[model samples]
Target: MKIKLIAAAAIAALGFATSAQAHKAWLQPSQTVFSDKGAWLTVDAAVSNDLFYFNHVPLPLERLRITAPDGSAVQAQNASTGKLRSVFDVELAQEGTYKIAMVNEGMFASYKLGGEAKRWRGKAEDFKAGIPAGATEVSASESLGRVETFATVGSPTTGVFKASGKGIELVPVTHPNDLFAGEKATFQLLVDGKPAAGLKIEVVPGATRYRDQQNEIHLTSGADGKFEVNWPQAGMYWLETASEDAKTTLPDAKQRRLSYVAVFEVLSQ
Candidate 1:
């Protein structure tokens, strides 16, 4: 129910920094489940207070990654970053699903120096050199975040859903592009390529500024990391899940925080 705001200075490391505080970072595709091939898709990226709105700062595109249905890398075109949002266009030339994401990895740490508490955030590669030698009571947590959305030109494909074995990711039992209203969809949450059992998932419908309440559907992954969501009605839904554990990829850090978010549009059945 609480939405966290981000300062404009956090734009460079949107993913890692936002995980430390909190922000509704998302990639909103203009359309999903397209009926034809070779279609062009427009996507808007932002960290907003309301779902899918551009009232907040733009999500930087430096981390943007586009994957074609064949698992090949695709570049974003006509990309622009504005005050409140970043927009880009992707050409669906391969005739299957496409994954558009801002994948980020960084380090977040807090420690005591000179009897004063200080914090630092930077790229994972900079963790060792960035920490002061005399810093005491040091605590560091690596962060991996993926803000993504999917689009299908003709038929949906699974290539785009493959997990990177780092952060929390959604493995679809029901294809993201195939979701529908009044029906249940299954998905599995994974962290470091393993099952993320009991992790909490929040799914909220878009256009919430006009609504009285969020109407969020809360779910917990099962023992096998699987969970189900029954769509309340046909609309774009923002799905988010986060976890923190001692699964740090960096030995210097004690823990790692992982977050994954995706936008899915459900059609009327």
Candidate 2:
């Protein structure tokens, strides 16, 4: 529910250090199964460019939440962080798909307009209203990162596909939990509840605790805001997309950006 806001001035102060290192957060569970009781799943989390490489670090519990099959909260406990990634555990008491998500709300501004770098936090509306009156030219991208995945126990369910009312959400056209290797999976990109077009989405094989890479496919959403991916192998897979509007709506920031991520496992033959 919180995003790290980057100000136009801050970008200059740091000399735009991390601009090239774009990252996406992901959640991976050790097991997806149903049980009578005492069923637990170990989740490995990280914000990285590669699957599970942990090159970017992991999200804290405050920014992470897991919803149970019955639409209840499933708390993650025993969290520990390292240089590349973090790990946690969650106990499941029901049979259905659980959604684990990491959400951040923030804005990015470019200092290229000259003068001092401006910094703003909190809501996006506040940043829009607070733009300096004297400012003539501004270039920036306000982004929201909505990263999530589904872990299903017993049989798969459709309840986990509900939108969280975030900026850009990936609504699975195919049941995410039912994916299998060598099959096709489709998803719709929802921008403010409607299908979004021309968005860029990437599908890649998830990283292991070590290192590996398979086929990485990049595609653009069609007129219907939908895209499909053919699962190559088994293990874990990552799907991500982002879109931005830079036309400046007025009384609002000059630019806005949005990003979405989803990870799921495919059964191997």
Which candidate number would show the highest TM-score if scored against the true structure? Answer: 1
lDDT of each: 0.81, 0.67
- TM-scores of all predicted structures: 0.90, 0.77
Top candidate (lDDT): 1
TM-score of 2: 0.77
lDDT of 2 at 71: 83
Expressed as tens digits, the lDDT of each residue in 1-269 for candidate 2 is: 11112221222122122332345566877855454445788888766666667676555555677888788887787888767667888887778888888776655554322566654344455655656666655555555666787777787776766776657887778888778889998888988778888887777776644555446688888899888888878888877666656633334466666667777888875
Error of 1 at 186 (Å): 0.8
List pairs with backbone clashes in candidate 1: none
Candidate 1, 119-167: lDDT as tens digits: 8888878877888899999988777778888998876789888787877
RMSD of 2: 5.4
Count clashing residue pairs per candidate. 0, 6
